[model samples]
Target: MLDFLKPPVLTIQEFFILAGRTIRSIPRRPHYLNDLLMQMDIIGVGSLPIVLLTGFFSGVVMGLQMSRALQTYGAVSQTGPIVAITLVREMGPVLTAVAAAGRNSSGIASELGSMKVTEQIDAMRALGTDPILKLVKPRFLATSFMLPCLTAIADFVGMIGGYIIAIGLLHLTSAEYWNGAYRALEYDDLAQGLIKPFIFGMVVSLVGCFYGLRTTGGTQGVGRATTQAVVVAIVWIFALNALITKIFVSR
Candidate 1:
């Protein structure tokens, strides 16, 4: 009985020790830098179109809804500023992070878990290659870099979407819309929104990689890890969003 208990405790300690070793090993591996670049392309570049589409539709919907609401008070002219401010301050980072979690978390978990199940990760260990440094560190770094870029793209596209809706659907002139939007928009809103996605990216990547590395058993374990990764990533994103909002907005 003591032996069994000791194994579990030892395993837990080993996991943390491995994680720390992995972190320290990152700078020594050049392959991880290459992998990190590839991951950035996959996680950031490949996901751009979807993020843009989502941002566009969200902006259109927000404009339509806000326009209707403001019309009742004869403030329809405020639509541009309202849509721009809301998108920059709230919708862009939040939506981009949610979309990224959906796209990347499950994929990361499944890929890493499959590698583990196939013993490829074990092979790397046998070869004296640190799997965590080669795999997880690159992914974490890639996510940290890419998520902010994705959010910036999303913010631009979302603003364009609002522009289209205001000009086409609401009969607002382009100049009028741009003018009001520029007047109300501040660098602070963009900075605030842009900062959140970087943190969200780190959270999503770390959780996904952590769960992936923890997978055991067989194919069923991989499936379970993938599902858990997405669920946990989303939950953490939302919780972090609230915490960040409170920190930034509670002023």
Candidate 2:
């Protein structure tokens, strides 16, 4: 029982320690620019299609749903602002993180887990190289930046989707919808949207790397880590969102 209880606390501590070390190594000598770029290509460019599709569909649904709700008060033109706010403030970043967690997070865990099982990670250690720097740092940097980029793409695409539904389907004037969207979206709101995904990106990569490094029990452990990484990262995303939202709202 103590062993089981210990992992919950121990793992968190280990993860943060690993993060702190990796972050500190960044400005030191022997920076992995090439590796970081490669990871970015994989994490950012590779994720574009999924993010675009997610944004489009989410916006369409939001516009449609909000249209119905707003129509009750003859406020259909407000759909644009509503959809924009929802996607920009909450849904876009959160959903992008969710998609990334499902795709990149699991992939990171599985890739690291396989490397661990194959003893390749051990080989790197024998060569006097830090695996966290060589491996985790690249992924960490990639996810931290790319996730926000992906979220931005998704937010733009989602707004287009909202436009289609609001202007095309609801017969609302394009100028009215877009103007309302522009009016409702303040600098603070947009800034928050931009910031959330970056934070979530780090969360996903860190959790993935953390669980991945802890893999044992052969292939089974790898699978376990991959699943746990996704679940834990997602839970943290929502929890963080709540905390961040509270801060935003209270101000």
Candidate 3:
């Protein structure tokens, strides 16, 4: 009983420790510029299609629902602004994080888990190289930097998607829809949208790294860690989303 209780506490401690180490190393020498850029490409470019698709569909559906609701009130034009604000403030960042958690988080965990089981990480240690510095930090920084970019893309794409529905299907005028959407957005909403994804990105990357580094039992352990990483990343994203939302919105 005591031992089982320890894993959760230990995991939390180690995860924070790894996060601290990652943060401290950011300004140090031998910066892995190439690796960081490569990870940015992989996490950013590689994840773009999914982010765009998620945003597009979400916006379209939101516009559809809002159109029906607003039409009864003779406010069909407001669909654009409503959809835009919701996407900009919530859906864009949260959905993108979820998708990335499902895709990239698992990929990172599985890759690192495989390395752990194969003793490749051990080889790095033997060579006097810090795996955390080379591997974890790059992924961590890449995800952190790329998520806002991805959220921006998702927000833009979501607005376009909403525009298509609002202008095309709902028969709302393009000018009215766009103007309303533009007017409805507050700088705070944009700020929150950007901030949420950056925070979620760290959650995804660090959780994956922590679980991956702790993998055991060969291939099975890798699979387990990958699954755990995705699940945990998603849970943390939602939990953090709520907390951050309250903090920002309340102020």
Give the winner by lDDT. 3
User: Each candidate's TM vs. the true structure?
Assistant: 0.88, 0.97, 0.97
Cα lDDT tens digits, model 2, 31-150, are 788999999998999999899999999999999899889989998888988988999999999999999999888989999988898898999999988898899999999999999899
Best by TM-score: 3
Q: Residue by residue across 1-251, what tens digits does model 1's lDDT show?
A: 57869965875576566557656766675566678889999999988888999988888888889878988998878888998888887788889888988889888899999999999899999998877778888888888889888887887787788888888878889888889988988877777788889889887887778778888989999999998888878888889888988887876
Clashes (backbone N, CA, C under 3 Å), per candidate, total: 0, 0, 0
In TM-score terms, candidate 3 sits at: 0.97
> For candidate 3, which ten residues in a row score worst on lDDT?
1-10
lDDT of 3 at 109: 97
77-172: candidate 3 lDDT, tens digit per residue: 789789989998999999999999998899999999999999999998999889988899999999999999999999999989999998789888
Please state the error at residue 36 of candidate 1 in Å.
1.2
Q: Which residue ranges in model 3 land beyond 4 Å of their true spot? A: 1-4
lDDT of each: 0.84, 0.91, 0.93
Ranking by TM-score: 3, 2, 1
lDDT, model 1, position 34: 79
